[model samples]
Target: MAERAAEKAYYRFLVLFFNCLLTFGSYFCFDIPSVLQEQFQGNLSCPNGTHYNGTGHNGTTECVEGLGMTPEEYNLLYAIYAWTNALVVIVAGFLIDKLGNRFGVFVFSFLTVLGSSVFALGSHFRGTPYLLPLMLTGRLLFGSGNGSLTIVQNRITAIWFKGKELALAFGLTLSFSRLGSVLNFFFTQQFESRFGIQWTLWGGTLLCVLGFVSAVTVSVLDKVGMKQLGLDGVIQQESKKVRVQDVRQLPLRYWLLVLTIMFFYNGVFPFVADASKFIQDKYPGYSQREAAYIAGAVYDSSLILSAAIGILIDYVGLRGLFAVGCAVLTLPAFALLAFTFVPPLVSTIWLGITYSFAAASMWPSIPLVVPQATLGTAMGLATSVQMIGIGLSNVIVGKILGTKSSELKIPLWRWQNMMVFMLANTIACIIVAVSLNIIDKKEGGTLNRSTKRSPTEQVAGQPADTASLLNDVDDERSIN
Candidate 1:
């Protein structure tokens, strides 16, 4: 009894630790760019006491003089980052399957630490043209770690939680990650103002180190928990003999649900990175630092609301609840973009609220459709598809902003274009939601028929050997 209690405590600790580690890393996803802009400002310091009018150490300078890159260049860089994340998710599926979640998390966390350190070092030596390559290299490595960590988080959650509790767990985990984003909003600039951009990057490096330590601790706790539960050896042996079977296959409806998530993320993730500068450009009165604060609030607020909505998904079911959430989210997103000429503060706040509602519903619904054994693969595929949308949207928004002019013939700034792009993306999401509802109904009908069929008809429909393979897959999953 003592051992069992100790084991339960360990499992709880493992879940909390992994959730914190992943959330810390997610915060850095947006933090790095803000740090980069600060470093760019320091590097592009004026040559003399006489300040260059547009190139002075002010809010716009970070975007114009510091980065040296035009809007198009920055967009391309962001696309690369998004694409790298997508590839990492796809690769991590196989890596977790082979290495197990513990080993995979450790290896990936170590890579993140290294990548962040390199990025910090590169920021300090920005005079060298080589810094760009080094920074990109670091981002690529970090992306891999990010992908691996995502897969591991979902797998671990599926293992430790069940039913509606799992949805809450997932939602709460996301909420912590949003907390990181909130920290990034205020702290990144504060760090840059205090020590320098290098120190800011170093801060992320330190977080990565902490993540590595937490991952190792979780691995140890996981072993203890498994042994106490009498599942350690059983899981290992079963993993070796595991095979893909028809019953284990995810339905097409599941893929549609994933697609909806992909569309939502496509708008949200890139916006997190780009919105600060975009807002500053559009509003003009607000400083970049102020914009960053608002942007963080926007992202973090959604996470807070999402946790509540995630619980709602458990009671309401995905088909109607998620679809309605997506539909409602579109209204604010479109309103913000369509009224671009108006004061943006109100719209920004509304957009933030809408986004939170959609996200809270969408992410929690994934595990309901996919079983544990194949959860990693399903999430990987879903994330990869999301990245594709993110990458494309970044480029498209960049082009639209860089090329188009407003009604007055003034060139529409990048941020304004981004808002327009987000509005359009939200509209696309509505269509995806409608399609998903249709697919869900069809899948439900099919499952009902399959379950109600006579035993002889079920046996005759599939060969005896194939039916046995299906049973084995289900049995192994049930053993958990």
Candidate 2:
């Protein structure tokens, strides 16, 4: 019993429990607009084409039960989140590396609390002129906090689980974080129906408080583990002052990984942002609630399946090949969504499967290619680039949809046009994934090495040739 009490694996997973909760609030609040699109756009029907004249099915928008924002305004909420993260996350990364992820977690989580509060306030004043501005501000804060919190989470994972179960750890984090998104889609509409919109919005703020408490808990657990393991100095020592030049030192392989995420997520996330409304537009039978459920399949499927794929990638090796295959699959997934009249559930599932596979392979690959000292910076850089792409994509989508809301139903042709853009982005993502595979092979396949192949290896070493991150720096700093 004493032996088990002292086990590092036991404590590590304890920390993982709270680590997974760190970003829950941001994700939960992030997609509120997507699920609430019709109401916010001044329509009162479940299906998009339910034109009512106050008595029956008349050929006019009812405009009774939402905030009445335009389509451009609806999409701008998402754009603000992405844009804020694009500007702030890179700097936040450097600071996390310099100050330590223990503290970084608190800072980012606190930001979420503040942001969510302001957002609730915005919703509270829904009829005022301040509504849009406050909402944008709240999203701005939430985006920065969530984005930086992700950087810290990735860095924390590397610090604690590096060279062992790294991919699985990452998969767990993704599954857990996205659980927030899944819950939002599942419950936001229900909450609004039961307790009114203001209370529903406040619920997100309450979740942010949970996130903050979890952040503090994980930090305490991590510090205790470091002391027990005698690595407090090692962590602090390696996490030294970072320089802007360090960004340039990140390898070409790392940059390629960044490129893969940039193009790939542009297809997935922007779509998720608008998926509920999209489903309502194309499919005739589903209600808004049912459409929200179908849209959330992207996260729900991933929540259940990504950990299994992570375990597979952890043992199977060949992550690059896995990435290539996943990227290629998204092409057909988007094609079916774009051109065919088949049920959208099938395409959503296809997307979720491919996303789970690719994420399990891709994110863990970052620690393999770069030294620990630069991990936070690399993550931040990648996140910033991704935010830029996603933000612009939201804007571009807004432009495509235009500001017309007579019937609240976008034509099938416009839906196809949007899918075409996603398909093109997915094609680029596949090209880059292929490029990443070719480049990784030429460079000794560090990313393709599996831990199962090295049963005798120590926990301190990686699956392949990794730089001696701790040794290169003074004994004063560690990636912790």
Tens digit of per-residue lDDT, candidate 2, span 424-451: 8889988898888889888877778785
lDDT of 1 by residue, 1-480 (tens): 767853454556456566556547645644567434423433244355212122223434421224344455555656766688788886676556545778777887787787777766766555568767777777777766776677777777656654324455666777777777777887777666656566777888887887788788778776777666666665566456434452247777677777777777667666766666555555556655676777776656666676686565544445345555665565675466456556555655666676666655665556556654556667777777887788888788668756331111124454555666776676777777777777666645221122123435434543321122224434667896
Model 2 lDDT on a 0 to 1 scale: 0.80
Q: Give each model a TM-score.
A: 0.82, 0.91
Runs in model 2 lying further than 4 Å from the true structure:
1-7, 43-64, 404-407, 455-480
Displacement of residue 418 (Cα, Å) in model 2 is 0.7
Error of 1 at 393 (Å): 2.1
Clashes counted in candidate 1 amount to 0
Candidate 1: worst-modelled 10 consecutive residues by lDDT: 403-412
Instruction: State how far residue 127 of model 2 sits from its true place (Å).
Output: 3.5
**Candidate no. 1 TM-score:** 0.82
